[model samples]
Target: MEQAEAQAELRRRALDYHAQSPAGKLSVIPSKPCKSQDDLSLAYTPGVAAPVREIAADPEKAYDYTGKGNLVAVVSNGTAVLGLGNVGTLAGKPVMEGKALLFKHFADINAFDIEVQARDAEHLIDVVAAIAPGFGGINLEDIAAPMCFQVEEALQKMLDIPVFHDDQHGTAVIVAAALQNALELQGKVFKGVKVAIVGAGAAGLAIAKMLRALGVEAVYLSDVHGVLHAGRSDLTHWHQPFATAPAHWTLMDMLADADAVIGVSVRGAIPEAALSGLAAKPVIFALANPDPEIDPVAVKRLRPDAIMATGRSDMPNQVNNVLGFPFLFRGALDCRASQINQEMLLAAVDALARLAREPVPEEVQQAYGFSGTDGLSFGPEYFIPKPLDPRLRQWVAGAVSAAARKSGVSRL
Candidate 1:
């Protein structure tokens, strides 16, 4: 089929798939039996009052007496919905539901997707803070850039439970892991490589910070206004840390001679001609969804030695956030973590990077229809684990939980 026809068919099938269900992607089911009057008594009213009273007396008892320990609220204001951008709360419901689905399917965690129509950043923060008592963790989703930073920072400080903006931290964790393996494959060192990041939005900024934390020597961040330089009047406070050192350079100039180029920007933002200027065997992660900043095929044609990745599932080394969030939250919730700290994130990254180097299971290979023995091996094309790999839950969750304990964030 033609690309347009294929997309149309996918749209039709997606609608049918959602409509065929009980009208949506998710539903709440009782964890315990509620078939008899005896069961009902224990599940509610007089019998349930015992646990409620215990929780009221000692607030920490809620983790034991109620479902709060394993429940996450996937909250969103919908100011940025993937590539669609600022589609509002209601329109962003499907994506949030999909996130909830991943949480359940991947890590056996329960999630409630909450779409809040808040007036502003403060209102969103206030609303989330008010309803946060029932959840073990909060996964903030789809909020815009500067506001997203503000909302996450405010919530993390106010709430004792783990408050993570998945768009920022999730992407950061996966990208860091992939970059680790990709650098090794190309015989490059993190501390020596010059990295250029396009689109200094939530994901881009977070990735830059995480890379720097992982010991990358130099990171150049560029938004639509070109390279972020010191004293730029338009730069937000969050963008200030990433501003280049008193130099004037276009995005193309920054890309030139860099070891890697990561894009979280819009489609076609990075010019194809600029690929030639990159260091030999450059690592390119054109991570814009549905479409990338530079076409992978064109990149390969121009620089076949380049290591390439995208946000699409069909691509090799796809940096999907699904690889991080579910398991990260699982570990955090299991350990009764107070916050998702940097140590936890670094542990998650290391776990993922290590997992990719191991041999792929036959089951995972079969699921993705890999026929050859070499298909799953770690290399330039296979720098990250596939999203459906069941081992992610065990590896990432365990590492994160251990890190939480070591970092003094775990209540368990």
Candidate 2:
């Protein structure tokens, strides 16, 4: 098939797949039997009243009495639906449902995708806060930036449960992990390297902060205008911390001789000419979905020694958020964590990085259709573990739970 035909076919199949299954992707099934009057009594009404009274008295007993311990609310306003922006709440339902599916499939966690029709940031925050008592954690998804930051911060302050904006921290955790392995493969040290992060939105800002916490020497951030420099009038409060020194530096200037270039921006944002100026054996993570900041193939052609990754599944070393959020929330919910903090995120990053260095299992190799007798292992093409690697639930969740406990955030 031609490229356009292939794309058209994919669109048709995706819509059919979603439409074929009970009209949508998710449905609530009772965990307890409701087949008989005896079971019904225990599941609701008189017997259920006992647990309700206990929870009313103690509050903490709700975790034991209800699904509150295992349930996550995947809340969003539908302002930013992947590459398609501001498609409205109803249009964004499918993506949110997909997230819920991932939660159940990947980590055995139950999720209710809540698409809130709030008027503004504060309204969305209020809505999430009001409904937060029913969930163990809140996975904020697809809300636009600035507002996303506001909503997350407000919700985190008001609610005791883990409130995570996956667009920001989820992408950050996976990227940090992959970068750790990528740098190691190139014999580069994090503390000595200068990093350039294109697209200073939620993901870019979060990644820069995470890398700084991991002891990277300096991180230069850029948006549509160019490199974020001090005194730029367009800089929001969130962008101020990432602002570089007052210099007339373009995105190309920031990329010049940089040890690593992380792209969370739109397609073709990084020109071909810029790739040639990168440091020897540079790590390039062109992580924009569907289309990346720079084409991976073009990057390889321009600089043969460069280590490359994209958000596309077909590409090698894909920095996917699915690798982080499900298991991260699983650990947070398991330990009754109050918040998913930076410490927990870093723990997840560490687990992912370590897991990449270990010998890959046969199941993982088969999942990705790798037929090599040597088995799947860490290299330029395989810096991070595949999303289907079953071990992620164990390693990431364990590490996150441990970090939560150590950070004094875990109620367990």
Candidate 3:
């Protein structure tokens, strides 16, 4: 679709969507038989007592006795939705509802959207922490950057169940998977890659830390005001640990000889001039949603040998968080993880990247209706599996669950 046409079409769809009103994506339905008096008695009064008694005797059995095990909650304050930014708690409903549907569809996990109107992070954290016991896991979604970091940290520190901010780790996982694949494809070593992370928000910071963990030699993280140097006195408390040395190498210097650049920043953060000095076979992920920091086409034009990826599904080599969130949550919830730590996140990345390395299959290709599935050449674009691919849930879940077990954080 052309730009003008796409905009008009989007507006039209938005109007139609609002017209249709509530009753949004899904509704809760009873799973047990409820046809007669015997059924009602069994499902509610007499039979329910048996499961309740068992669960009371052994608390862990609540997972088996109730839907608590496989069910997660997508909790948000609507303080930030996409780039729309601060749309209010109630306005964030549609996005949360959509996420719940994706969780159910991708992982056989039941997710409910909880939108609360809290005065601040402390208020929201207290409320969510109080309610956290009911959920097996919590997905903190589409909340703004620094605030998101604080909220997730507070909740994870306070709660027993896994609390994940998909914007941070989900995006980080997929980017890591794609970066691994891209580097492999180009015969590049991750160890020596001078990486530049543009956007010191949740996703960017997470990516930076993960890359550092994976051995990227050194990475210079930058936000709008420029490089996050050790001497940057204006750094927030949330961004402090990342304040490292060698402050002389600014973003300009860092990007001058960088091998990989991950842009989660605002539009057009990387000027064409900066692209000129990047190392050959540059693995650049301009992963800003809706619109990437630089158009992949533009990046290709400026740096012909560069490998490009984005957050948009319409484009080839899309580096989307959808590739990781459902499966990661599946594994974490199943393992009864106390929190989604670095180990579990890295494991998911490894599995996802490994899956990308295999030859694409016929059925998987058929699923996309794109003809790459029958042991076809699956490359960069296919690195991360689509959320609806039906296979990654178990694959990713197994990796995370195993990691959680290994990390000694698994209740299972």
State TM-scores per candidate. Answer: 0.98, 0.98, 0.93
Worst 10 residues of 3 by lDDT: 372-381
Regions more than 4 Å wrong, model 2: none
* Runs in model 1 lying further than 4 Å from the true structure: none
Candidate 1 lDDT tens digits, 1-412 = 5999999998999999989859989988988999999999999987999998899899999988889999999999999999999999999999999999999999999999999999999999999999999999999999999999999999999999999999999999999999888988998979999999998999999999999998997998998877988968899999998997446687778998999999999899889989889999899999998989999889989999899889999878889999999999999998999999999999999999999999999888988888676567888888899998999999999999999999999999
Residues forming the 10-long window of minimal summed lDDT in candidate 1: 244-253
User: lDDT of each prediction vs. the true structure?
Assistant: 0.93, 0.92, 0.82
Instruction: Look at candidate 1 and give me any clashing residue pairs.
Output: none
By TM-score, is 1 or 3 better? Answer: 1
Model 3, global lDDT: 0.82
Which candidate has the highest lDDT of all?
A: 1
For candidate 2, the 10 contiguous residues with the lowest summed lDDT are 244-253
In candidate 3, position 155 carries an lDDT of 86
In model 3, where do residues sit more than 4 Å from their true spots? Answer: 14-22, 245-251, 372-376
Q: Between candidates 2 and 3, which one is better according to TM-score?
A: 2
